[model samples]
Structure formats: C-alpha cells, structure tokens
Target: MNAPFPPAADVGVPVEQPMLVEDADAVAWDQSTDLLVVGLGGAGLAAALEGIERGLSVIAVDRYACGGSTAANGGVFYAGGGTTIQREAGEDDSPEAMLDYLRIEAGKVVSDETLRRFVEQSPETVDWILRHGGKLAASVWKEKCSYPPLDRFLYHPDNSLVASYRARAKPAARGHRAFGRDGKKAWGLGKFITEPMTQSALRLGLVFHRYSEARQLVVDRDGRVVGARILSTPEGSPEARRFAKYIARANMLLAALPPSIPLASITIALGNHYLRKASEIEAKARFSRLIRAREGVVLSAGGFIMNPAMVRRYAPAYATGMPNGTLGDQGSGILLGMSAGGATALMDKVSAWRFINPPKAWAQAIAVDRAGERFVDETVYGATMGEHIVDYRGGVAWLIYDKSLREAAFRQARDPKLVPFQRDVTLLNLLFNARKAPTLDALARRIGVDAEGLVRTVATYNAAARGEAQDPFGKEAVDMHPIERGPFYAMDISIDSRFLPLPVITFGGLRVAEESGQVLDRAGKPIAGLYAAGRTAVGLASQTYVSGLSFADCFFSGRRAARHAARANV
Candidate 1:
C-alpha cells in the first residue's frame, strides 16, 4: 500500500464555517409543518421560501451548510429569453415558444405542460431573485440550448473581470449596482448568496435545520409516504433536542441507510481531506445506498457524489466501453438516483468533466501546440479555446507537427507566460522549477504518443491547413488543429470538468404533472401527497443548457410544490 500523501498546508481564505448541533433528548412537539424539505441547496431554499409565502410551515434540512454547490459556483444565472435571446436578437419569444424549446430540448422526456409552466414562471422567478436583493447585469447574452441551429436562447448576468472591478468599487450602500454604468458582466463569485437565502427563509417563518442527514423515507403499509427518518447526531445542545422532537412528532420512519461513499477527494474538497477519515467516507457511502428503494425515496442529494455502478445501470450511455481515460473511473450521484427508483430517460453519452482554476503548464502547452499550426481562423480558435479547455478529454493530446512550421508560431508568442489565466502557473512556478523542453518530439514522448506517427500526422494536417478548412476531425469544435511544427511538443495538460455533463442541477427530476408539481407513476397516475422539484424530477432541458433557466425552474417548482403540498391533505 502507498503511504498517504503529506497533507497540504492550508491557505488563508475566508469561508463560512459549518454549524454543529448536539443533544437529541426533547419530547416537545412545538409545531407541525405542511412540508418537509430534505436538502437546503438552491432547490430546497427555493421551496422553503416559496412554501412560506403560500402560508405553509416548511421544514428544510441539510447535512452540510446550506451552500452545497451554490456558494462554490460562479454566480452566473442564465435565464433564457428574459434577457439574451429575446432582447438582443429581437426575436418573438413567448411562453409557448420557450416551452416548445424546452420540450424539444429534453427530447420528448418532459411533458409539454410542464415545459410551458417552466417557461411562463421563469421570468417571474428572475424577478423574485431581484426582489430579494439579488442583482443582475443589464447586458444580455445570447447562447446555446438543445434546439439545433437555433441554440441561441439564454442570458446570464454579466460576470466579466471589468464588471467585478466595477462592483468592488461601489460601496454596499447603493444596493447591488443594478448594472455597472457600463453594461458588462463579470465572472467571479458575486456575493454570499447561500447565507442571505437562509436568512431570508428563516425571516419568512420557514424552519431550517443543518447537520441533519436524511437516511430514508417512512412509508405506511399501503406505500404512502408518512415522513422521513433522519439519522442525526446529538452534538449536544438545546436546539438539537427541539429538532429531534420535531422529527419524532412527524412520525417519520427511516427508509434506508445511506450507502454511497466518497472514493477519492474531488478537487474542491481536496484542501480538507486530512479531516475526513475512512469512517466518515464510509458513512456517506452508506447513506448513498438508500436511493435504490421503490417507494417514497427521493434522492435530493447533490449529483457530485454519485456511484459509478449506478451510473452504468441508470445512465449506461456514459459507461459504455468508451476506452479508459475517456471517462473518469469513479462515479457518485448516478447510483443515488437509480437506486431510488428514478429513471434516467436521456441516458446517452454525456461527458463528465469540470473546469476550475486552469493549471499553468496547460496555458504553455496550448500555446506551444498551437504555435505554427496554420488551420482555421486563429481568432475563432482563440475565442472558443475556453470551451475546449473546459471539456478536455485527458490531461494530454498529440501536437502533430512537421519540423518547420512550429518555429514560426513559437516566435510570435515567445513567452508562454503571456496568457492571462496563468494563476495556476504562477503557483506552479513558486513550487517547482520545471523547465520547458526545446523540442516537440521530446514533449510528445513525455506525454505518451507514437513519436514517429505524430510527426507524419502533423505533416498531413499542415498540408490540409493550407486548404480553407483543416482536416475532417471538426478541428474548430474540438480545438485540435494539426500541430505540424518542428521540434514537436506534447506537454501534459489538465482538463476542466465544468463543460461536461453535470447531473447535479439536473433538468429532469420527479415526473410531476405540469400544473400541480405532483409526482406520477409509470401509468401517469398521480401519487398521493408525493411531489418532486429540482434535480429530483427529470426532464427540463436536453443536449444543451440555457444557464439560469434551471435555477428559475427550481424556484418556480419549489414555489409550486409548496402550494400543492399545502393543499394535499386539505
């Protein structure tokens, strides 16, 4: 066995700490809520807030702090039509048009009614966010969705660097500078949304509990869901007792033990791995297994911790023999949904990847690979390279080049360090003095490729580049232009997971009737008092995404779910 790697020293960065509650010994049942929410991320918070607005007592809980992925994400909400497509393109976009777009995008998986509801309520959801002090950039962005060539149909709040600087310059007093004087977007974490949302829900009379891990759903003999049995620890406090009493009075029974375990630390959580013991990972793995049961079980857990086996079983398209290194070896959320009797209809070959802070070596590698490679317009490649970086297949790709052409490109961008997104490189340089190898051939061999074949491939690609379009291999789309430069370099590069198929904020969730947010069985019959929202329900968008639309759908559905839940036993 290998000795565990030395724990990395911590970097000082401000982060909201997780709160702990101890002591589960109270018999007092202070109140009964109309709805119980399992997770407190975007979906749960939306539901609780909306439920409270509709005059229902809502109970929301989370194992971790409410942030989950919300706090960690680049605060870019892309709600389509509201800003980008309609405002910029001057296209006629109505509720029907948006619904049609979503239905077609979801590949017939989502009902027309549901799609329409999503479309109609999306604008309202955006307004609600604004109403709650969330800000948006005035500039609208036209982007892609699943509807073929007509992909331009979304808008994200401006999140560019200039915009960030502008926001920072303003004092908190002017109230979220509606749009920077100059209408541009910024690409950084805007503010602490999770905290504000939690505070808002609490102020609105919704109850929220942290550190409560839901184990299973309790169903009566007739398969009717009574409540949930959550396994909680008595961290020892008066608040903990009150929380326990709330659970007991609800008469919730434990449905299944959590079974999915964290196999390895994801990049974001790597900083804190030393604190995570084997037992902790094992407990999470146990909780993951509860997703397999047939009744009253809904996995609202985020998609980051899916099981690989379950992904293959439910989302088989991702696991089909696609050559190793093509896909990640471990899986997490896929199993959680499948085990809980959730059906993944669009189980196709979706990419599993993420893009975070780009590594320094990669900027150098990309510049080196593209040097002297005369293919399509260089500007197009430059503009779309970010997308390619986000969906990088592996940490490496061959830089096929003939000896001569390479010299020309290198002379232009002599220093690889010129690229702006070299924060990773800045850190890497501080840690290691890795020198750049002079020749492409040496780099190719280092990154693992047929050295001789790489030379020939480069020569061929160069010849093709002379002609208008390069080779048949969609060079522009994948960002792989034939690197036929001398002294070929094939430096190791890292792929970002951002552009890949993320099931976490899934478009599809529980099969709910469009009007009521009611869960339906295989035969389309509504399950009594059963409802789903957020990623727990399936089929919202397809093939492509429109950014903030999912958030809008979640807000709308959460509000709708509360309305229906309040009227369920009425």
Candidate 2:
C-alpha cells in the first residue's frame, strides 16, 4: 500500500459525523471478499455483477433491501449513440450527435474525454442491461411529454427536442424504458431493471447482506481503503424475520395500488407503516461486523436528498421539494468516502422537477413569476422550467391560461393514453386547484400576482401568438395560444404548491476519477483501493439532469469502478 496522505477537510457537517476511517490492523474482520459493495441499488448491483463477471469475489450490503431509489424510478435508461432500439425505431443518432447535445446539457461537469467515453459506451450499456434480463421496447414515442405514457416505452426525456438543442444536434428519442408485463400498472417501472439485475447477480454467487448498512471505511496503515464496517441484522434474527413479512406486504400493496386510486392513499399509508416498522426493527437489531475487501470498497449508496440536514446544508433552495428517492438515500456512501479523504463536487446542485405536461396542452400556458413577468419557454423540459422558477423566481410561479387552453388541457387529460397517475393529477390540478377569473387582471389578483404586470405580459404574448412579433422565449407557434379570452385561469406550479408537488433529487457527491471511478481527494488524486459510483460520485448529471441519465451513468460508472477494482493489485 502507498504511504498515508493527510485526510482532506470535511465537506461541511454530514447528517452525522461519518464513521470515517478505521485502522484496518485494529479491526477483527468477520468476513472478507475481493470487492465490498455498499448499498445494493442500481449502481451497487451493477458493480457486484461486473465484479463477478471479472472473476472477483464480491459481497454487497444494503440498508434496507436491494433496489434503492432505482426500483422506484420510471425505468427509463437514457441511451443514444445509435442504440439498437433507436435503429429499430428508424432514428439516426451517433456518439458525436449525442455528445453535441450532452455537452451543452452537462456543461463541462466531466471532462470532454470522459463525456465522449460515456456516449460511446451508451449503446453497449443498453445491450448489457438486456443481457442481464432487462427489457427495452423497440417502439418509439414521438411526443412532447414530461414522461412517456404507460403504453409508450421510448421517448425524449431531455432538452433534445427543444429548439435550442435541436439546432445543436438532430433530436432523437433516447429514453428507453424497461418493458413491463401486460396488465402492469404505471409507476416504478424500474423494477424491471433492478429486480432482474439483482437476481442475475445473486445467481452468479454474489454474497448479499440485506438489512445492512456500511458505516465506515476500513483503511490500511497506508491510507488505502480496504474494507468496511457494516451494521447488519442477521438473516435469522427476529427483527429480520419480521422485516421480511412487513416488506413483503408493503411490496404487495405498492404493486397492486397505483397512486391514482382514491383508496390508494389509505393502502399506501398502511404500506408505509409496515415499512417504518421494518426500519425500526432493522435499526434495533443491527450489530456491527468488520468485512475486509482485499481489492476495493465501492460506495454506491445513492445521494442525500432524503437527508433533511444535508438538503438544508447543501441545496437549501430545494429544501421544501418532495424527495424522490428511497429511505436509504441519506448520503451514507458519500460521507463514507468523504471520511476517507474524498473530495466532493456540485454539492449545491439539485434536480427539482415540476413537470407541467402529459396533458401536453398545458405547455401552451404561459408561466409567470410573482411579479407576473413571463420567464421561460413554456415548452421547455420540466427541470429547466423548475430551475427558472426555484432559482430565479423565488420558488413561486403560476401557469396562466385562457378558458379555451384550460378546456383543451382537461380534454387531453381524459385521453386513455395518459398514465393513470398523470391523468388523475392533471384532473385534480385543473378541476379543483385552478383559479378562475373573468379577466387577466382579476386572474392575477386571484393568484396573488402583479395584476398590471400580468396584463402586459399577456398582451405581449398574445401579440406574438397573432404573429405581430417574434415569440420572446422562442416558444413554438403551435404552443402559442392567445390569452385574450375574458375567462382566464391560473394554476400554481410553484415549488411549494400543494396541488403540484415538486420532486427533488440531489446531484452532488464525492468527486471521483472520471476514468476509473476511484474516489479522489482534494488534490485531485485517486485514493487507492477506494471507489465510488452512482449518485455517491459526481457523474454525467451532476451539473444538470435528465430522466434516465442518472440510471445510465450508474451502469457506466459502476462497471468502470468494478472493472478497475478487479484489476488493481492489492
């Protein structure tokens, strides 16, 4: 091992002081493996699978169970570079073209070389998932939607279709959602990917410890990370047995009841009770075990959006947004790496999504700030609009529309093609929450915006709709409906709006080697024997996010870390 380097300064106060580094020589190891993977989420599963493929003995630990936030996701895997699905859909896309768009979206968060490598590997990444039993439909959905409808499995989930990005590169649908079985409900489509990958890893002799959390990194005298201290509930323990039952019931309810059903709230609340009980039992029964990793310790435990303290400390602006990850997404992996001298980056970046489409007609509505000034192209990606509202508009905005536009949106919400959740939420927002008034000034007053400012903004927008001037925000003419009707409506699309909750995910964590996914210190040098992947490490979406980009990066970065660790000399 190399000589010990001085530990880097802590990246603010963590949710709690990370267990940091423990002297390897002072610990008694209960188990050992060539690679120790923390948090069996998408990234950890990928690393474990990859490590097993490379003939390395791997052991994985998860706080709850396998899946993590990935299992709760919409199952979209952002892939381009002429993937088989793209070709099957008759879409022309290449690594160069993909890079052209991503360069702008990613904004130099990663080196050009790293970004190019990511794009180049994208097609193979899709293939790798398929090889591991993950499914992607060949059909493409060409629509301007926040997310594809249940029947559609492929779409563009980023800024690629927007005018600005279309000019930079030919737009193509890149979100490849994992195929669900017939009669399957919408939501949590990610189970198709995570479940199969987990089974594949298990079948390949990967040792997994559920109800276990990695608390600290174990480092050799030379400051090389070699293992971890895991707190785990033994499989046969009373708490573990009870947790299995609770979690099984919870999963059953989650699978059976989509959020759109009115009774779903009560059933889901019961499911949450089971989950909470499971967590309580797990916490009570945990006992620490020292596990040595001969080659490397991979931290893939996800991000910190669920950690209130971390959210408030880092991306405070998004503190009020609903967190979108599992309970395990509390920055344990990132903090574990930080304790081992890992440098963090983009800690302030968060993806606060306030999607306004699905009832795609809603995109025609002009969004205004508190002062009633139009701020963004209504048809832009939801995250872009959300950023404008939260970062620039004091976390408040309203979608202003005439009665005709509102009616159109309501009609579209009734389309059978819309997912049940989307349809229900849209109907709820429009039918119950939308404020109606006789005039623009009255509408502004009803929604608590500047009345005169709203009137002027609408006049300017209507002139553009009538072809008297260019659209100020470059919104397409097709999405420009004049708001001159006497009956006007304003729907709150703000970050804190009760009717339209914004789901947020943190996009920041330990800075790592772009090539190998090795945790890097403040000096930009890789820490020997330590690696990080997924949200625990800064990757493609650290700067700005798009749907499926995080999942794709999980595959790319996880495999990179696993392969590098497997080949490294201990």
Q: List the RMSD of every prediction in angstroms.
A: 13.0, 4.1
Candidate 1 residue-wise lDDT, 84-110, digit = tens? 324444433455444444453343655
What would the per-residue lDDT of candidate 2 be over residues 5-86, giving only the tens digit for each residue? 2122323322232343557656678998999999888899899999999989999998777888887788888999999888
Q: How far is candidate 1 from the true structure (C-alpha RMSD, Å)?
A: 13.0
Model 2 bad stretches (over 4 Å) = 1-27, 182-184, 247-276
Tell me the TM-score of each prediction against the true structure: 0.57, 0.92
